[model samples]
Target chain A: MPPKPQNLKNPIIWFFASLIVLWAAPLFLPTFYVYLITEILIVSLFAVSTNVLLGFTGLLSFGQVAFFGSSAYAVSLLIKGTSLPFAASFFISVGMSALAALIIGLFCMRLRGFYFAILTLAFSQIFFVVVYKWTSLTGGDDGIVGIPKKPFLFFNINGPDAYYHFVLLVVMVSLALLYLIIRSPLGEVLQAIRDNSERTEFLGLQVRNYRLASFVIAGTFGGVAGALFAPFQGIVTPELLHWSHSAEPLMISLLGGMYFFFGPIAGAVIFVFIKEWITGFTEYWMFWYGLLLMLLIMYLPGGIMGFVSEHLKRGKDDSR
Target chain B: MEFSYFIYQLIIGLSYSMLLFLIASGLTIIFGLLNIPNFAHGALYMLGAYFTYFFLHSLPGVSFGIALVLAVVSVGLIGAFLEYVPLRKIYERSHALQLLMTFSFILILDDATKYFAGTDFLSIAIPKLMDGSITLPGDREMPVYSIFIIACGLVVAYLLWLGLYKTRLGKLVQAGTANKEMLSALGINVPRLFTLVFILGSVLAGLGGGLAGPLKAVSVGMGETVIITIFAIVIVGGVGSLKGAFIASILVGELNTFGVVFFPSFAMAFTYILVIVVLLTKPEGLFRTK
Candidate 1:
């Protein structure tokens, strides 16, 4: 008999299996669900980026959408005006976002807690207003529409299956890289800083450098998600840069449980599905959504993943 | 170039500052005492504006003074209800959860306003008695209503200061904030005090919104429109300090007035820049402890 298959309980094996499923999902699902899956993937990447600062570094940023929106516009502009391929445009978009994050992070990382959140929010709002007023380049309020998603180098990546596979590959690779970082010596130091910054400083670790590094990493991933999203949606709008939009991934991170590594992915799935389902029913979906969030906070402050973890631990205790 | 225009802008800015102070003082109080950042403070303001709009429009022969009083009291009741039900439980939860709940209230309140008031902008007509213009020494004429707003703000501030310093309830609240465990140990009903504070804060916010209705465009998203600026003011003023809120509101309002005149291009960005610079220099705020 063949050796027993790898245990599904292991997170690494589970993650790879989930990636395979994500890759194969479009072949069996309806077109609408496929679109939903794509949204989930994009938002998951965004949420993961948010979690890097929020969960890992204990920094709550309220302007993560700045990078996301900026990258979207950058990619859209490049694709619209230049002869660069999709891959090159994406690279350029992420690079531009990283540069922006570096500059903003210099000013922002100095402050912590509410001040940091507010500063980031102010920066994003400034970006939003500028984009809204800069009609010449950004198309202002009407936004840049009809962005073309070219076929990937030598692969017909226009169809849902192809795009889904491409996104799956990209997301898996990114996650793998993130996991490596988490398991690295730098990741250990970052965790230490999160638990006790004063102690970490006394230990001679550069707390600010670690924070800025995590911020840049988060920003680069946010830009990558934004670059993917522009082509997927075929539009890049000022709304993407709005503070309200920035709140989405933050909300997702909270709802999914920031403590877990894959918490944002779970959150992305729940958020997109809940939004899609609720909006289908009534225009007052926001009211109910808000009520649900209130309820969740009151009763389940640990979020969905945290709730699951508690139950799993209880189950193990009972079996023992 | 015009002297009267400068004075007019100054008064208008001060009036705007009064409204901001009324709302932001309550916000700062709630944040300081409860250690909960109430994002729904804006919703209470919106409710106040909506209530004033309906009261003034629907009721014939009712004075603006009476309508304003009714609007403040009613919005205060709604705020009390929110605190008693949803916010009361999450008092001990993480800041993230508190933020989420408040944020959810924003969505709920926005949609509720949309459902009731429709999506269009609603304007309140100023009372005929106060609608007339006052001629300034520099030959610049400004609305008499603005002067009334400034007077109202002063009256409210005086009352709040008196209540906080002189009243028995004020002593309890001060004691509670300083040492909640001790207050509870001494048999003070801490929860009741919190409820009272929440109501007072809510009413002030509502009053601010109601008074501002005539000046600003009152619409579905109007609460969110002013909230960011208010947050900036609160941060700059020092969170939880009433005096700080007052001073910060004036500072931000003056910045807005002058920012528009001197730097039209950067008018909107000025408040945020001020906040950033102040925060960098003094991260806790200009007046409060970290």
Candidate 2:
């Protein structure tokens, strides 16, 4: 009998396999490694959510931080101020993001390309300014501090290890949901719009409505990540709302392979490690990082996953 | 507010508007031709201020005018290098890539500046020629530098208008902005024109920075603080319209000034609100050029 090829190409199997490994990872790893992985997972979720718009829908937004930051702030405030359950606070924060996205998307969807990017940026800056100047409500630049990691649905997820497990499970479920979303018909329609909105509109689909849907979807998931981030960090700041901070996920998406579903995960791993490694040695890390980004944009626009997939295809072609 | 105070604030707002116009005009012109949003334009403006300060301090007995000229020229050279190098490779790429590429320049330039300039807020002195304030009828005082800035803005606007509309090169620029392929097909050197336009834009940004040094804090983060406001002006005016940038700059500058006085808490939000309002009403901008 001929040798059977490996089934590594199947993402579900890979997903479950990675989940098993990651779920067991904290058992062998130190508390620091566990915390680091938690951070990476949060960033990966954020990047993947952003990719839904940039990669799947072909929209380059500069205001995604608004959703993420607002949710972070909301979750933090609710945890600190009210007696609501963690789950309720989480849901409310994400819901607020969705509502915010809908309203902003309504205005922004009318514009395209550069105009869209600028309008979204303008809106996000409004959020930033509000967060920065609303000292009584937001604590202004000092940000909200000392946020407790309260119990969630009878689970004591307060310590670093417990929180890591909670984050891992939540991120995995979110990733799975996002994966299913991208694999569904809505995802196909979004991609179709990305490739050619005029053709999609010719098919009788309302392009603007679809874009708004994508925008809200991105914002909702971004809110989830933000909600996760607040408890993980034990604090939240207005810096989260800044437009410059919005670039992190976009850079991660681009670095990971915006086209691939698992690309940002790969990117998040590399990005976190690289940032850690670089910042360890030099304060001039931004200069080096900028240089890397420039080179990537210039020569490696397809990113790491794109490069890997292309080489794999070439190998298959050569064997054929 | 008292009438004299209102006039005083109005003049101050006009000076700020002129400075903003100088920066936005360059950005609009560069965008008009090169079709790339130069995120590093603000960085260049920062460099202009830094270089002017360096020139003034390093070269003893050097007048501020001499320092300003030298600083602008240096900025123009850097702009040329930027255009000839990384920016040149991305003309055929997507706007996302172009934006990222330009954004990288900001990171590089800002960090490089911090490495050399040491993260301090450096200030430049107003030239002796325009250092004092004039008293108005109601005992309100306005800085002479404010009047100088307003004059500089009007002169530059007039000169830019003349160059853009009255000169042959300006006509070529306008033609190129309208249709690059046609201009290139006509045997005009489009690449050279692009380089020239980019340099011109950079010089304007540099001049704005140098001129603003005496009025505002010159620091590493100054580029970032101004870039968003500059972008709002450009978009509000119309991406490629000089007149649009001018009008939008004035509107934003005055709104910010008055907002600060009447509604301090809402001041920061005013420019963004104006942007949202304009984009919602007229997606292309108020004075959209072709």
Candidate 3:
């Protein structure tokens, strides 16, 4: 008798169970901790979105944070400059990033592997420079501060817990959709391309189009996270566009497990918590981080999720 | 713009182009031969600059030339150690591991540099003989140091030409670049050739750093700044071609210098725009064989 994998048995039931647990987490946590969880949710979404290109499509984009930060800037400016609603600005920013992604992707997807990665970084750096130097418009290094936000109609969702719930809802929906995306035929096609791009091409699929689609999807999702970040944090900065910020998602995805559907989210949670814990003690967190990253790359190729998957596989093998 | 001033800026651009060529060529060779995208090349360059600065500053009467040579040699050795350490172990791994390890090296080297050199910017002293400016045909005075840099670049270029076209080792490296397994089958020690090529590549990068030390302010962020620009050069030049790297560097240097005169705010963006245009038209690079 073999045990059934819970994930495949009843995904809907599992989703609701997980959501209910997450929804009530704030109830047990202290009031000050709401901000922390909200941040985790945003970054986790960012990580998962990055995995779209990296894990599924096999394209390593180092400039993902360009979309994230640009979306943040766009949303922040839209809120301040126009009378648009939050939803409008959010979607608009995401749309802008996707459009930008298309433009950049058209040029970048011309190359494969290492060349593709560097080209993306180069493009992102260009954007970063623009945002940094355009002080008159983007506030340069000072960045735009005091960004205003409007709560949902008559809900008065001003409190931290209410905002947390709002963020949680957005994250849940985004993750659910992304999960569906990963489970669909489209997802299968992407994995096929990642596994053997030549064979996928030989199978009558346009590899470049799929890769470009992935770039746009990942960029749109990353933009959504950034859009959420600006209003959630009440600020937008040029640092968001920096190459280092782009590297964060890569680190998170790698750390959590690139193979697992939920790996990057787990990685992002671990990353934020580690950041919070380490920064509490020392300013040289980067040094420690480098050391940890070295060890992780050297020893833990599967990340935390990889480790879990290996154990699960071992259990299955033992049972059989 | 006045022709005289344009030529003056052009000379500055040329000198900087030479330095850029030195860095990009090394990276080109390493990428061609070893198949490892050595992200730490910039860090190695930065280390050379810091080394030269320290030696020159600490030993006041010591000549800048001696300091430069020592810096290049020492950093070359350090780069060899870097290759022997984590890089050798992960050569068989995925591109992800190679990239992560190199990135970790960047962080580690950056922090280590901060620990040793502190957070302050350091500059090299121009040698007394080359401290003066020389009068040009257009009645503009050009820095002798700039001319020296250009001369050094020409010398290195000529030497590289001789090495590649006239020497046994260069042929070995070139052959290895084409097919490592075939080169090994011909009874050559391919691993040693790889190590030697890596060392040579680092030495070239170090030389660029030494030359650049006196020109630019040495700082913590200099490595990353230079690396990105060099990446542009390497890409535009064609990944594995020295000729391409040389031409692209000059193009980039000129664009950066003169582009500022036209649009001061968008000077840097011009290089990236040029890069995008190149990627669109010639994805393999300007000098790619295929």
Give TM-scores of the second chain, every candidate.
Answer: 0.95, 0.98, 0.96
Question: What is the CAPRI rating of model 1's predicted complex?
Answer: medium
- Candidate 1 local Cα displacement, residue B151, angstroms: 1.5
Candidate-wise lDDT, in order = 0.83, 0.90, 0.84
lDDT of 3 by residue, A216-297 (tens): 8899889889988998889888888877677788888888988777889899888888888888996666777777877787
Highest TM-score model number: 2
- How does candidate 1 score on lDDT? 0.83
How accurately is candidate 1 docked according to DockQ?
0.65
* Decoy 1 TM-score against native: 0.93
Tens digits of per-residue lDDT for model 2 on A164-263? 9899989999999888888778888888898889999999999889999999999999999999999999888889999888888888888878888877
Candidate number that wins on lDDT, 1 or 2: 2
The predicted structure with the larger DockQ, 1 or 3, is: 1
DockQ of 3: 0.51
Model 2 CAPRI quality? medium
Name the runs in model 1 displaced over 4 angstroms: A1-12, B58-61, B137-139, B175-182
Q: Quickly count the clashes in candidate 2.
A: 0
Off by over 4 Å in 3: A1-9, A157-159, A315-320, B59-61
- At residue A94, candidate 3 shows an lDDT of 91
- Which 10-residue window in model 1 chain B sums to the lowest lDDT? B92-101
The Cα error of candidate 1 at residue B241, in Å, is 2.0
Highest-scoring model, lDDT: 2
